[model samples]
Target: MARIKPQALLLQSKKKKAPSGVSVPTIIVYILIVAVMVFSLFSTYKYWSRRSILQTQDGISNRKFIERKKSDIPNYALISTSKGQITVELYKDGSPDIVNEFIDFSQKGHFKGMQFTRVVKNFVIQGSKIENSEATEDWTSRGKHYSQLNTSLKHEAFMLGTSKATHEGGGFDLFITTAPIPDLNDKINIFGRVIKGEDVVQEIEEVDTDDHYRPKTPVQINEVTLKHKT
Candidate 1:
């Protein structure tokens, strides 16, 4: 046999060499690609999650408001006003917190000497503000407000609503509607209806108001007495 050249043998050896596993640089590139993909997915998930939570908050808060059953105490609200007395039969089923708190405060004389602060002709006449009973200017439905509840009762003709002057919430101000205000239904709290003196509510509404709907003359709430049936 002829002697093989060392160069030829070396070439043959090089050609027969097997490939090792993936190179360090290639493995590093793969790891980097996987990390980037994970980061992108995580960022997308975070963005959508935060958006969903904020949207649900508003709906949840309104739905979470408490509703109470009518009490056995024969609850009634006797609003003695300058125009006349309006007797409201309190409801226990629609909104309990509003009814109970209002009666509780009325019994405590918290609403003593309060007055009607706002009036909308053919719509509503709101009062129950203890402050600014004398001053027409700088007084709103929020005057002396102490309670809050999500709207429960509807605004029908001769119906009563208690709300803020701006209708924002938590003024504990009284609003009595002489006409059906479908827009205000489920948007404000109504704890009672005028079982007596609906005409009195109309009389209060007929009182003159300024351009801002503030009564030109003060309509006083002499007292709010909570009475229970014997």
Candidate 2:
């Protein structure tokens, strides 16, 4: 009931006042922290999403290649060479575009006078376009095409492969292996194999070659005839 001094009353009133609201700087800092957390989460989600898409695409491409290898086609090629007549079973299903192009060129007599450019004993024999050859088609305009190297097909003995094309123009080059080459299994596009004339392939392999594997005696592909199962 005693009369309170004015200064004492004022001090008591200040002490009883409610605490002020959070400062503007503190609120702004909290908002910035939340924004940073949201951005981090969004960026993480996008990185994983892109990775998943690439994985799915790779799986699809591999599956399609396997399916094509399982398919069958009734086609063959008889390459009459200076050494002998070598018969091959074309893998049109595995490498349809390359096989078809080879068949078309053979039918059009494009390989009439081409010769085996390179040969390595117990390795491979490669065919290339030679100057002044009897190829009637104008090969200058022909650009490089996909070799379709990835497939179930392998580089076994007597297997035929199409070398990867080059910028200087080399889609039609043929490679015939004389032995199983595990190194080139997934690297070369194998499209056929020797169904006949195993001895002929061996004979070609025995031919003398220079240090660079170029045939000393130019082995010629006299003719290439495409056939179908009757």
* Clash counts for all predictions: 4, 0
Question: Which residue pairs overlap in candidate 1's backbone?
Answer: 68-96, 69-92, 70-92, 116-127
Candidate 1 wrong stretches, greater than 4 Å: 1-72, 128-155, 164-171
- Model 1, range 13-102, lDDT digits (tens) per residue? 999998879999999999999999999999999999998997799567655542222334447788899998989888756767778767
Report lDDT (Cα) of residue 170, candidate 2. Answer: 35
- Minimal lDDT window, size 10, model 2: 138-147
Give the alpha carbon lDDT tens digit for every residue of 1-230 in model 2: 99999999999999999878998999999999999999999999999999999999999999988776534334889899999999999988788888877876787887787888766655677787843242323221110111223333344678898766441443377888876665665546788988899999888878887655567888989998877751
Top-TM-score structure, candidate number = 2
Best lDDT among the predictions, by candidate number: 2
TM-score per candidate, in order? 0.54, 0.55
